[model samples]
Target: MGVKTYDAVIAGGGLIGGAIAWELARAGLRVAIYDRQEPGHEASWASAGIISPAPEHPGMIPLVPLGKASAGLYPRFIAQIEERSGQRTGYRAQGTLQALFAREAREELSTLVALHHGLGLACDPLHVEEAREMEPALSEELQAAALRPNEACVDNRLLTRAVLEAARRSGVEIFAGTGVEAVWQENGRCAGVITSAGKTAAGNTVIAAGCYSAGIGGAGSYAPVRPARGQMLALRSPALQIERVLWSERIYFVPREDGRVAAGATVEYAGFEKKLTPAGILSLLEAAMELAPAARDAEIVETWCGLRPDSPDHLPILGPTDVEGLLMATGHFRSGILLAPVTAQLVREWIVDQRVSLDVERLSPLRFRDAPNPAS
Candidate 1:
């Protein structure tokens, strides 16, 4: 018997891949997503779900437009997914606060605020008292803070599940616990993927396997993604009434509507090992306590690690690859949730419509063809 073929076969069933599957399937394409484990249980579940461009580096300026575009589409995008999938994603628009503890950091933040304002992003500098008024749980000794009113967050794990459900509703075939061993090609053009179960053919293939993307056979050195492990913990504090996402230089606090606080995360290049270290938890807990002293008594509910896909330049590797009919949409690092909508929309445009409305040349997989390996 011939192997079953799909219009699109996506490797890696994380948020990016799931979103693409939902979009493509909704557009009447027969799509299938294969993941080695349960979909979205990896980095997507471990994410803090904060959605904003503030935390990105200055070098990621090229991606700002894409991030903004995704942020703009999130409201409608999430609502549609929820309606279609019949699941709530815990979406919140309470905004975010960048807290400054010292005078030096406050001074530095002023420049960042100015830059953001110049770029037309809505970031307002807040007086210490005003900051306290907005988030009464904040430390009283904070020197300064800034508010990004447009920034929002969603429960990424819930969102992932919703996307997967919506994809299924749109007739996308999902294959969990299926690892694609290689990109099966013929006549020098991209074909399909080889999985432990067998070969699955597709007219176009997308490698969205997160940190494990670069290792997929037949991809060669196209995807320069590497594993950057991040550690995070959640605190269940019913009494802590925090309204917005709080950010400091060291840690971030995301207040869930159910009174749980999500605190994270440490960026460590410890390879594929995802052990939860005590130091990682201590540093996060200390920072969380500094932001809200009462949180010290909060019960630590969960601690886990995720391997984020990090490119050398730290921007997402999206759009087409050198191989025809093959695409790449991994290496989103911390901004996976923030960039999912735009990535899906653009990928759909490029694959089904033959062109992307946004100029994503910098994000193309071809950018690192001549660049030296990041490990060196």
Candidate 2:
């Protein structure tokens, strides 16, 4: 190949950044990704892999297309990776079954149903008995439920491994433990990024550092990304074979291939602190017990905390910034894993065609007009 300075330098080797780097490499760009730790072991690894755009807020209608488009890309993406890497992403289209436990939760179901339907998605409301019949482990007190048949999920950890493999196979260099110190600028335009390792990564750097995107210099106010801590737990339950992804108000359970049930997530604004708390763990356990009694008998195998990259407007920051060459693809909140596929494509288009096919104006990095771009 030509003297490689890397056609694109991706900050952060998480799902979003890794996928983008892989796609860019496939698009004939010599790409490299940097991460402070192991790729996919953060929020992307600490997720339940529920790809449902089902239970999301009705207010997020504008972004539903983006999510659905991403969801569509996943099947082919996972298929390619699984074939190439011989590692299963555990891609499942079994759908998500969300339950209603209280009157308030029942009321919330209507809004979810409407939103899903509006997106041309298939949603079926089921009576309590029907719901329990579908999942006999459900409590008798369950009020209502809904199923979005097209909703799907994947084993996020496996997906991450596949992405890492695909990227490596595509000749993308991954530098773990290389943190970005700052984005270098000269003449008031875009330049390069300086790594904490004392190395300078230049020529089309994409700041996709998840929650830490704000810490990098020249990230500017463009980084509206915030760190929302989510505590998760996994239980080894050979007794509970959940056929589909199950969800209640505060918790959800996604079954993996190894007879382990992945249940999660308490969203707390705990600031960069990834420590798992007893209170959060207790709350999730109680919720799990309520949702699936079999879970109460299962052994708690693991617990962890992940930082969801959130934004001020509760939407992800996508597309180019005011900086000439620097692009942003962060702040996915709880949906980072689900949105990874599309984010990769969107970012690759920006790097290649200098445009994306999706209507990403709503996720503009410059959305906050008063937000100032920083200097290196």
Highest-TM-score candidate: 1
Off by over 4 Å in 1: 371-376
List the candidate 2 regions with Cα displacement exceeding 4 Å: 1-4, 103-111, 199-201, 372-376
lDDT of 1 by residue, 1-376 (tens): 8898999999999999999999999888999999999998888888999989664667877777888889999999999999999999999987899998866977778886988886668888988899999888888778889999999999888999999999989999999999988999889888999998999999999999998888788653667788888898888865567888999878998877678888999999998898989899899989988988878888988888899999988988888887888999998988999999999998899889989999888888888878765433
- Residue-level lDDT of model 2, residues 1-376, one tens digit each, is 3223667888888889989988898899888888878777787888778886543665566678888898888788888778766778888898889888887866778876786787788888988888888877777778889987888888899888888888888898898877887887777766667787665545788998988888888785787677899889898866677778888887998878786788989989977888989899999999998888888798999898889988887788898888888889898888888899899999988888987798899999888647543221
lDDT of model 2 at position 224 = 65
Worst 10-residue lDDT window for candidate 1 reads 367-376
Deviation (Å) of 331 in candidate 1? 0.7
TM-score of each: 0.96, 0.93
Q: Cα miss at 314, model 1 (Å)?
A: 0.8
TM-score of 1: 0.96
